[model samples]
Target: MNLFEDLRNKIGKSVAETGQASKRMIELSKLNYKRKEKKREADRIAEEIGWIAFLQWEKEQDIRVNKDLKSGLERLQYIQNEIKLLDVDIEKVKSDKLLYSDNFYPTSNSPSSEPSALLIYLCPYCAHQVGEEDRQCGNCQKRYY
Candidate 1:
């Protein structure tokens, strides 16, 4: 048996399947974390709603909810909507992973095309893609927090 040829074949096969399935799973995890943060924000808004209502009651005995409480409730609703959208995004990521097969071949669009996932920052205002070391976004010219 040609030992060198066998070794090369095995290594080539391993290199071909870089496991996008795992990458998608990792992305799903990040989406879940974002969803959890939104939920926490909603909880905080709920607390603010209650406190504002109590203050209005203590002042003049008005049973009608004030604009402050209504605004807080609207904010809570917006946060919940965000959480739902995240859930949809998580599902889409998972479904895309399902399309992956173990016997995949290498294409020009390989894993090397992807930058280091940890070495990039997305702009909060506009999608100004930049490296981790970048302090400002090139497209939007916004300072990264």
Candidate 2:
């Protein structure tokens, strides 16, 4: 009877520890997902600002006076703040655990040859390669304009 009681206690502790670890993993994943989303939005807004400034320069207009550029800057700031908050949450969830950056492994996909003469343009939304004449991204279908 004593042996059976000790075995049951050990099993119960293992189950509880596994459940807690699973819950923490789920929380961490959710936080990381939200951080990625915020970062993507920030990237899009920064790209928009760059494009607006370029267009203004091409038209010989003042980029500072561009309303779209100003708006994109404000949105980018907001997204950056959100990313900071998500980072805090992720750190809290990952307390006492090794960070993703702690384990580093070199990737095997490095290019060995020189760059090609042809330049490839990637869509800002989906990162799909598009021709210079493409008005919309084929992957995301988002208009370039």
Candidate 3:
């Protein structure tokens, strides 16, 4: 009878120890789950910050690009204006040369061969030379005497 009582006592102690170990394991598992949740939350916040920083960078790039484009267009406009002025100057030089050459070589029908005090009419629309008896312009169809 004494041996059976000692065996029962040992069995009760072993059951109690097993229950305590099970409780400890449950607590440890809960702690691990909480840590994982905290880490996930931190990662989410980091992602949001990164997105905001990217948007700001994009805005700055847009401003710089716009400024560059505006400057380029202004430079192009200035160059075009200079080209137009140069073309006008070239036309004036050519007209002056033509006048000088014509004066050097007088035509057979020039005013020098005509009688003195000869009457001539000029067309007002196209500046065409006309005879004194003419009443209409032949080049631009304008009426002029």
Top TM-score prediction, candidate number: 2
Ranking by lDDT: 2, 1, 3
Return the TM-score for each candidate structure.
0.55, 0.63, 0.39
Q: Between prediction 1 and prediction 3, which has the larger TM-score?
A: 1
Count clashing pairs, candidate 3: 0
Poorest lDDT segment (10 consecutive residues) of candidate 1 = 111-120
lDDT values, one for every candidate: 0.70, 0.71, 0.52
Deviation in angstroms for 77 in model 3?
55
Tens-digit lDDT string for candidate 3 (1-145): 4435545654654565455446555655564555455446545545554455556567774333244445545554554555455556555655544543432322233534322222346678876766677889777788864
The number of residue pairs in model 1 that clash at the backbone is: 0
Show pairs that collide, candidate 3.
Answer: none
lDDT of 3 at 33: 57
Candidate 3 Cα misplacement greater than 4 A, ranges: 61-145
Worst 10 residues of 3 by lDDT: 111-120
